[model samples]
Target: MRPADHDELNRLCKGVKKSFVHLETRDSYGTEVELPHMATWRRGEPDDFAWLGWWLEMLRGHRAAGRTCRRARVVSEPVSDYQRWTMSHVGLFTDAGEDIRYVARPRLATVPLPGSGDFYVFDDELVLFLHYTGNGTNLSFEITEDDRTVRTCREAFESVWALAAPLHAYRSE
Candidate 1:
């Protein structure tokens, strides 16, 4: 694929800004913690420090918010290794609100798409993909009408939710 022109890239970024920012990451913990920071950055004017400060402030603000927030939920297939680690980190910064719902399933048939990391997004919803590839993650996104991808993600989550078991229901502490 040919490299995108600078101006074209800028225009594309602007379009993304109008839509929602999509962030797919292997660092699940960092990305989750970075949400509020990203929100702060977006609310600030475009200065060199704007982005940096936004993330830093978001991290700080999230800690201050409480150990749980009324607005967050943990939906996953309950991978014994990764998801647990990711959610623990998420819990630490979720204090401002106290309504975190942990949704988990024992297994969901993996969806293979010839990639790594699956997908991670911070648009209208924060999406994390579980089955993608070997090591790294894949962060592919396509902008469709009125956030069709967001709906697609929500649907995917719901499907998994239907098949998943509650964490406490299945496993003993």
Candidate 2:
């Protein structure tokens, strides 16, 4: 099922009961809400990061409710400018109770991933695939509850997560 809008996606994510695991394979994302901040970063300007309040609050709520949220990012070594910038601010997410990790692309050569894009598995039962354009603009969200697909994505996320390092300890070497 395709989420009708961003709000629908947020509702689905908010409804996750036990766990929310995400696998992000993109080097950069051109999200409208983030682009301006990224530009400011590129210019060496300071940002208050107030825009992340909503997301951090949600993570806090999930944590308070005993729900676990994890994210594993597969990135190329010598990360892109976007990834570098993102990593710099990852503390906000971590501090808010999200477990975010990173794995170099080379480390996944021997691993089998379910698909070629990004996805989120909620409660290990629903899979939300994120479709993006070549330039890293999000296109749509497709959700599925098919057991096989969910299992494959969950396993793939775990495989990558196992090889990942916490963002604070990650080095691009």
Task: Give lDDT tens digits, candidate 2, residues 1-173.
Answer: 54545786788778888989999999999999999999999999999999989899999999999999999999996899999999989999999999999999999999999765799898988888888899999988888899999999998999999999997677734
Q: Candidate 1, 44: how far from true, in Å?
A: 38
Candidate 2, residue 164: Cα displacement in angstroms equals: 0.3
Candidate 2 Cα misplacement greater than 4 A, ranges: 1-4
lDDT of 1 at 118: 32
RMSD of each: 11.0, 1.4
Model 1, residue 90: displacement in angstroms?
3.4
Q: Estimate each model's TM-score.
A: 0.35, 0.95
